[model samples]
Target: MHEVSIMQDMLQLAEENLRKSGCTEIRRISLRVGLLSGVVPEALSFAFDVLKSGTSAANATLEIESSPSLFSCGACGTESWYESLRFECPECHGILILQKGGTDLELTQMEVSSTD
Candidate 1:
């Protein structure tokens, strides 16, 4: 249930911002979930459904971007995209992979509107 906890935290933060801005509703929430973020999209969606109950984001749509895992090989100094390919550089066949991206779970944007 890490997704539940994560969703709760995301909702709380958004709620705080909305409260401060005097917003009454949220139209959308956008996020970026990397391939290696260890978070399942289906599970996160479900968790959001459960956690959004009675919250400002209750009816908001979750816009998620599935980012692919990328890494740079130190041995060959090449950037490569490794989607569950054993973490090795395809060009150089190096065992060491310096992760460059696709390991982040971030809240990218939010849409808020006032009841006025």
Candidate 2:
């Protein structure tokens, strides 16, 4: 699954940051995942669990925050959020345009500890 590769990349980045900061233990890794990002959260979590062994993030906890798909009406200026993709506005029957909120998978935060 692609989640394996994605988790690998995330761990690499986290490890790089941890090393730069002289931290040997990764405590937590937080991610913002959009509904439309085409990523399955369960799969990603399983991937993280499997891939973290023997790495700097072996003991890290993965936190996923889900972002909903947002749409704005071009005619009525109505904004709405949905768990699924939407193309039409419920009010005024106006055409809805996609807004920037979903469709992104981002690593938001990471907590690390230095092993003094």
Candidate 3:
């Protein structure tokens, strides 16, 4: 699955950043995943469990915050949050356009132990 590759990249990035900051242990990794990001949380977790071995994040807890897809109606100016694909507005039956907040997968925070 692609989640494995994604998790691998995330771990690599985390290790690189921790190394630069003189951190040797990772305590936590937080991510913001959007509905439109096409990533399954369970699959990502499984990927993390499989890929964390022998890395700085081996013991780290992964925290995922889900973001809902937002769409705005072009005709009615109504905004709505969607958990599934929606092409039209529910209020006025207008064409809906993506506004923001559900198309990105981002690393938000990391907790690490500094090597003194």
Candidate 4:
């Protein structure tokens, strides 16, 4: 799947950052995945597991933080969280638009061991 490519990119970035910091071992890779990011967490994890072989992140744990999809009412400026594709304003029954968060895949932090 595409998650394999995504994990490869993430591992590349992690390795580059770790090398720059003089770190040789990665402990964890923390990611924030939005509900609408179109990236499946389980698939991503499986990709990482399969792709980490012989890399610095082979032993690294992949930590994913799930973000909920949020929408704002166009007519009333109200915000609501939903899990499905339907978007309806609960406050004023107005059309809901995506205001903040969701549809994002971000690497928040990486825990590594620097060997001096």
What TM-score would every model get versus the actual structure? Answer: 0.77, 0.81, 0.81, 0.80
Among residues 3 or more apart in sequence or in different chains, the pairs in candidate 2 whose N, CA or C atoms overlap within 3 Å are: none
- Please report the TM-score between candidate 2 and the true structure: 0.81
Ranking by TM-score: 2, 3, 4, 1
Best by lDDT: 2
Mind giving the per-residue lDDT tens digits that candidate 4 earns over 24-101?
A: 899899988888888999999999999998998989999998877778888998887765554677777889998667
Worst 10 residues of 4 by lDDT: 82-91
Ranking by lDDT: 2, 3, 4, 1
Model 3: per-residue Cα lDDT at residue 78: 96
User: Tens digits of per-residue lDDT for model 2 on 41-66?
Assistant: 99999999999999988989999988
Global local distance difference test of model 4: 0.86
lDDT tens digits, residue span 64-111, model 1: 887766677778878767544356667788865646667888888899
Off by over 4 Å in 2: 73-77, 83-97
- Candidate 3 structure quality by residue, lDDT tens digits, 82-115: 7666898889899999888787888888999964
Separate clash counts for every candidate: 0, 0, 0, 0
Can you give the lDDT of residue 57 in candidate 4? Answer: 90
| lDDT of model 3 at position 62 | 97
| Deviation in Å, model 2, residue 89 alpha carbon | 5.1
Instruction: Give Cα-based local distance difference scores for all models.
Output: 0.80, 0.89, 0.88, 0.86
- Model 1 TM-score relative to the real fold: 0.77
Poorly placed runs, candidate 1 (over 4 Å): 73-77, 81-98
For model 3 the TM-score comes to 0.81
